[model samples]
Target: MPLGRGYLALAALATTGGLAACGREQQTYCADQNGVVVPDVRCDDGSPGYYYYTGSYGRGRRPGYRLGGGSRIASTDSNGRARAGLPSTGHVSNGHVTSGGFGSSGHGSSGG
Candidate 1:
């Protein structure tokens, strides 16, 4: 039996690359998207913190985020527009923004 061309190519590439052929574990606190890895901290444990992301839909993508210690905060740009999450607190969405948690400050948008 003989090795296939694809197998030979893969072998050659792997041998040449050595350790580079294997990938490393992504950071626990970060996410990799389209070759650009960024922080994945959606909820800050601190009080009154700002979380920002430069996405395709908008520049300053910050939504109202509620931390664990009953601190509900809204993220805004220099112009003060709704950022990433949603109109309310404790709301997180991957496709669309949605509202969560009853009677919390900033709690009512309804998307994801």
Candidate 2:
């Protein structure tokens, strides 16, 4: 026996909705060239060092974010990308971008 078209549609809808549950309300934030959280003004002057960011959905910054669309407004780039050298919005350093940690080289958690 084969599944009905209705069942397939229902399954697809459920899967879409399931992924939507893991989202967060996106808000505008100022960030530097590396995507580090900076004062909101940095993005206002249309300068090079700053850009707009939605803080990556599903990261949970605040509340009341609709499913699907992550941000109300995207960054000011033609391709909708902030820049190539920007930081990863997943970790969310909260303006505390650190470089070169134990995870970088072959270093162990317990010091020798």
In order, the Cα lDDT scores of the candidates are 0.30, 0.39
lDDT of 1: 0.30
Candidate 1, residue 44: CA error in Å? 5.7
- State the weakest 10-residue window (summed lDDT) of model 2: 103-112
Tens digits of per-residue lDDT for model 1, 12-100: 88877765433311111111222122333442222233332222232222333221221122232222114223332433332232222
Candidate 1's displacement at residue 101, Å, is: 29
> TM-scores, in order shown?
0.20, 0.35
Distance from true position, residue 7, model 1, in Å? 56
Candidate 2 structure quality by residue, lDDT tens digits, 1-112: 9999999999999988766644423344445544455655444444565554443333432222232321212234423322222332322232222222222222111110
Give the TM-score comparing model 2 with the true structure, all chains together. Answer: 0.35
